[model samples]
Every structure is written in structure tokens, then in C-alpha cells.
Target: MAQITLDAPASHAPVRLGRLLTIILAGQFMAILDVSVVNVAAPTIRTDLHASGAGLQLVIAGYTIAYAVLLITGARLGDRLGHRAAFQAGLTVFTAASLACGLAGGTGMLIGFRFVQGVGAALMVPQVMSLIQRNFTGAARARALSVYGAVLAGGSVVGQVVGGLLVSADLFGTGWRPVFLVNVPIGVVLLVAGARTLPGDRGEQDRGLDLPGLVSLAAATLLFVVPLVLGHEEDWPLWGWLMLGGSVVVFALFVVAQRRASAPLIPGRVAGAPGMRAGLVTIFLCMGTFGGFLFSVALHLQGGLGYSPLRAGLFFIPGAGGFALASLNWRRAPARWHRPMIPAALVVAGLGYLGLEVFESGGVGFEVAMGLAGLGLGAAFSPLLAVALTHVAVADAADASGLLVMTNQLGQVVGVATFGTLFLSVAPPTGHALTVTCVALAVTAAVGACCATPLLRRRG
Candidate 1:
């Protein structure tokens, strides 16, 4: 329980940021990749395991809800322990869980192991931001954040593409299992590299963990996520509605508890940091829209249009190019331009989605339209995080990062639940589905733009 200040003095040698980013991003890529990678393989998994629709839903939702629920506590652990130590611990858990997921015998075991993997991800991910805050400053920090954003956004594409390849490859006749098993060797290498390369900074050991605040927040998140994830699949039963209502009440209780706790899970000052709240709202909107779009499009292409999994993933390739172009050129803009970038990008992305309507007749222009959408995604993706944390205190980086990530996961849940439902209701000739999803995304982007307007008025 000793506090170790690992930030070396000014006169000491500086660490290479590249080494740090590589180590952190490698672990993060693994975690983020898992989120979307499993999607393409869902059908294969169901066939191989004889999973029902509801059961398959659980397999996906379990990881997401658990990851969202435990994120704040994981952030606190990083603050109470060293970010480096906490990250390493998370990596170890995640790597082991991935192996278990590959080796699972049935839907129940895979779902259980997926939840454990979420816990590990919760522990590892927040520290990536905290470490960037701890090590980088000024323009260097901006660049680092931009890269982080790019990687985070790009991970989805990677996951979809890689998942398709893995499922198709069926390495050693393992079927969908290799998609997960591939992580083992990569994780082992990253774990070793991270331990040696990351700085050894310990947190305040004397500060006790806020047990009550933790419970309330966990309950609040679970209450919100579990219902949305299961409600539609379960046909919106009464208990799900009750849980949704209960989440609101529990969340209020959490806020009250946090206000009184001596060492609160998330300190008020940090939560109230300038631009932080607005940034979080913007992130929620953007991520939610993007998540919904991805989920709906995947289903439409595969289930409705009858594209092969690989072809379905390839349909997204144009968007990836657009994103890459935007991210690569992001640093060229002035600081003042950052705030407006998100809203503008959303508009562009929205228009791109709207363009898909034109391709409905023959699906001829799908790739081109998606390319435009990807461009919009690229422009705003990193800036969303950059603008959100612009004024956050370094000390609270881990907590803020955890909260930001949780919001993102929640947004994705909402997107999937709401839009996924919409897609399912219509079914076939997915042009209508595309229109519905695009309109919703456009509206969400507009909301994000509105939230970001205040941040734009403030100095960068």
C-alpha cells in the first residue's frame, strides 16, 4: 500500500512515447477487436453450438454489460494501485479469459468466460488514457490522443474483417474458436513488452475504495444495460421495464452517495471539469450512432442481402479508407477547430449514410457511399476524446477515461437494442432498414454537435 511517484524529475531521461503507445495500443487492440469480431461469427457459433437466438444474444451482451459495469471500479483500482500494475493485471486476466473462451464446450461456458474477459478489459483500458496523461504534455499529448482515437475507431473495422477471415479460415478445424484463440500468442508478447516498457507509477494506497459508491454505480449500469440487451430479445417483459425504471432511481442514489463519500469513486470536481461533461455527452451520441449503424448494416448485408460474411465485412472497406484519411490529417488543424470538427464530421457521416438510400435499387453505389461515411467518422473520432478531456486534471485522467468508455459502451448498447429492433421489424430489402438507421444516426450526430457547441466557444 505504498505510494510510488514514478514521474521522474525534469533532469532525468525522458521515456519514448512510441514505446508506450505501442505497448498500450497492442493490448487495447485485442480488447476492442473482441467487441465486434464476434459479430461475423455469430451464425457460425450458433450452428456449431446449437445456440438459440436469446442464447446468442446473451453471449454478446454478457461481455458488454460486464465491461461497462466494472469500468469505474477498474479505474479506481488503477488510481489506488499503479496504472502500470493495474494494466498488467488486466492484461493477464484478459489473456487467460480469451483462452478459456476458445476452449469452451458450450454457450454457457463461452458466455461466462466472456464476462470474465470483460472484467479484464475493464481493468486494462482506462489506464491507456491515464498513462498518456501521465507521460505526455502539450502538443505531444494531442498527437498521442489522436493516435489513440484512430486506433480505437479503426479497431472495429479490424475486428469485422479479421473475424470474417478467421471464421472462414477455420484454422485447424476449430471453427469460430480460432477468432479468440489467436489472441493467446499476441497477448503473451504484449504482456511481456508492457511490463518491461511501461513506467512504474503507484497510486495513493491510503485512500480506501468507496464500496457503497461502487455498488450503486454497478447496480445503476446493470439496471440500464441488462434490460436493453435482453428486453428486445425477450420481447420487452415486465421485469425489464422495472429494471429500466429502477436504474433511474439507483442512478440518482449513486449521485447522492458519491456527493457524501470521502473518497468517492468519481470525484465531483473531476466529473465537473470544464468541457468534460459536454465531451462525454458528445461521445455518447457519436458512439451510439456509430455503434447502431455498424450493427444494423452488418445484419442487413448478411441476413437480408445474403452477402457472405467476408463480403459483408468488405462492404465496410470504403469507410475505413475515409477514416484513415481523416485521422492522418487531423493534426494539421488548429486547436480552435477541434470542437467544431466533431459536429461537422457527424453531418458528413450522416449525409454519407443518407447516400445509401440511393444504392437501394441495385446496391451499386454502396461502397462509395460508405466511404463518405467513413471519412466523417475519421474526422471526429479522435477529436471527440480530445475535446472531452481537454481541460481534465491529470490526476483524474483514469476516472474520466473509465467514465468516457462506460458511456461509449452504453451508447453502443442503446444503438444495438434500438436500431437492431428496428432492423428486425422491417426485414429484407434492407433499403428501408438503412434509411431508418441513417436517420437515427443523423439525429444523434446533430445532438452531438449541439453538445459540442459550448466546447467550441471555450478556448482549446
Candidate 2:
């Protein structure tokens, strides 16, 4: 806490924050990048492996499903194992999995390794927020989190470009292999740095794993997410709807179990913090919109307009730039802007989504609109993240971090499923489907902003 004070040595504080953030965010970016990077390499993988359509889909969905399932448990593991150890162990697993994926000989092997990669990501990524929470506060925390937000947006953009470049280059004639191989060295560097620099936060005093709470929540999440991830691909089969419906029942049981537990995984006090729940809701909506936009726009560009996957991905750069610009600088705005920032900025994002209808796809107008959406979306994330944690006690930061991230990942899953399904099922024409999906995305943003407005206004 003393490090956050104005009186702290400027040089020391920045040096500490810089070293920690670089190590933590590099790992974070690596995990996030893998989520998108593989999509670009999918075609190449299919050709090389002689994969079926479903096998190819698994190569992509497997990582996400595994990642979603284990996140909260991983965060709790950090508390038990210590943040640094969890991070190192997780990174090591992730890096090894990356290597395995690169060398995978069959479609099944690649899919299996990809899931293992997700397991690694789940283990490592949660520590990032806990580390930030443990080490920084006040304006320092804000700046650190802003960079976190920037990474969140930037990773997806870079993944597309990097994936495109690596696949196109066929570096060493390895084709899509470099995308996975690329993480090997970066992971090694981060692992070494993290072992030295990451906070060795003391483990919580003898708290049991809270197995009942952990198992219940993990089950609820898996039941919920599995349906969303695979359902649309299967054309929303009856089993998908059944699983989706059943997740609610399981989640309700989880809540009941948590109430009875002495040491709940997510504490009541933390979850009940002012603006905490509301902030999570806002985050869900905003991120869901982001995920939806990316899926629909990329699909439109590549499938509908006949652009190469590389070109489709390239167009996302302007949007990524917009996101980085707004996320990095929004704190400089007047204090009053802080409270209204989340929803208000989200409205700007919605306007950008709507702008797609007014402008041609991949044109200057489209790029500008995409950038505007990115900027607005970028500005919105960090503030809500702060608000969610703003009232949380320091002791619960790790738990809070996991819940926040789990919610965010789930939102993206829902967004992509909902938007992608809408795009496919509603409008038969590619152009019409994009316009309709954009309109829907714009509407979701507005609703999210409206819901977020009151909590932020009163809280700020």
C-alpha cells in the first residue's frame, strides 16, 4: 500500500510495476492470443492433417471449453499453491503443451494438446489479476489494469495478424506449426522472469480446497459452457438445450452449497460489495458484444466478401488500435467521467457497431467505425474492472479476480454463440446476416450501458 502513495519514490514504484506487469501480462497475452491464433491456422491444419469438419472445430473449441472449466479452480489453486508457483507451473504446462501441439501428428493429437494448452492457460492467467491486486493500488492499479485491458484487446488483434503471417510464411516450411511454436520461447522467458519477480504471496491459512463449492461451481460452468460452445455447431440439438437448462439447476445447487459452507470459494462479503455484482454484469454484456462483433465481422469478410483469412484478420488492426488508444488514455479524462465512463463509452461502442450498416465492409468508413467501436469498448473495460474490485477487501482479491475472469470468458462464449447462431439462422444472405448481427450487437451494447449506468452513477 505504501508503494501507491505520492510520497513513494517515483523511480522505485515504476520499476517495480513495470517488471511485474511485463512478466504477468506477457503470460496473459500469450494465453489470450492462443484463443484466436488457431482459427487463422485452422485451414492449414485441416489440409495437413486430413481433418474432418468436426475435428477441425474441436481443434478450436477444445481449448476454450477446457479453459472455461478450470479457471475458478485455478485461481483458488493459486491461493493454496502461492501465486508465483501456480504461475510457473501453469506456464510450464502451457509451454510444454505448445510444443506438443506443434509436433502433433494427427488431428486427435492436436486437439488433445490444445485442450492441454487451455489447461495451462487456466492455471496461469488467473494469477495475473491476483498479482496486480496484490502488488498495486490506486492510480498505479488503474494504470496497470489499463494495460491489462489493452492486452486483452491487443492479443486478439495481434493473434490474427501473427497467425496470418506465420501461416503464410510457412516458416521453415512448418506451415501452421509456428503459431504454437512461437509461444515456446516466450513462455520460457516469462517463466524464468516470473520465478524471480512474481510475488510470492503467502498462502491463505489452512483453508481447505472448499471442494464442495469448487466442484459445484466447476460443474455448473461446464454444464453451461459446453452447451454454448458445441450447441450451435450441432445446430442446437435437443441435448444442447437440455444441458443448457440443466446448468441452471446445477448453478442453483452451487449457490445453496456455498451458503452452507464455512469458507466459501467466493466470499459473500466480496460478491456483495457495492458495484461488484453490477460491474460483473456490465462486463459480461460489454465483452459479449466484443466477442460477437469479432465472430460476425471476421466471418463476413472471409466467407461472404471473399477476402483471404489474412485480409479479414488484418482489418481488425484499426479496431485494436482504437481499443488501445481509449483504454490507455481514458483515465486522463475528468473525474466526473469516471463514474459514467463504462456505460457511456459502451454507447460509443454501440454506435460503432451500428455504423457498419451505414458503411461498406472493409472500406475506410468500415475501418473508422471498427476503430470507434474498439476505442469505446477499450475505454469501458478497465473502469468496470476497477469498480468491481474497488470495494473488495484485499484479502479476497484472488477470489474476486477468478470470478471476474470466469464471468468474462462465459460472456464471450455466449456472445459468439448467440451472434453466430443469429448470423447463420436468421439472414440467409451473408451481407444481410452481417447487417442484422451488427444491429443486434449495437442493441446489446445499449442495453448493457443502460444497465450499467445506475450502479456506476450512484457508486461514482
Candidate 1 to truth, TM: 0.94
Q: What is the lDDT of residue 30 in candidate 2?
A: 91
Question: Which tens-of-lDDT digit does each residue in 216-318 have in candidate 1?
Answer: 9999999999998898889899999999999999999999988889988888877888877887787787777778778888877877788888888888777
**Against the hidden true structure, what lDDT does model 1 obtain?**
0.82
Task: Tell me how many residue pairs clash in candidate 2.
Answer: 0
Give the C-alpha lDDT of model 2.
0.87
- Tens-place lDDT digits, model 2, residues 29-120: 99889989998999999999999988998899899998988999999999888888888999999999999999999999999999999999
Best by lDDT: 2
Query: Clashing residue pairs in candidate 2, if any?
Result: none
Task: Enumerate clash totals for all models, in the order shown.
Answer: 0, 0
lDDT of 1 at 78: 94
All models: lDDT? 0.82, 0.87
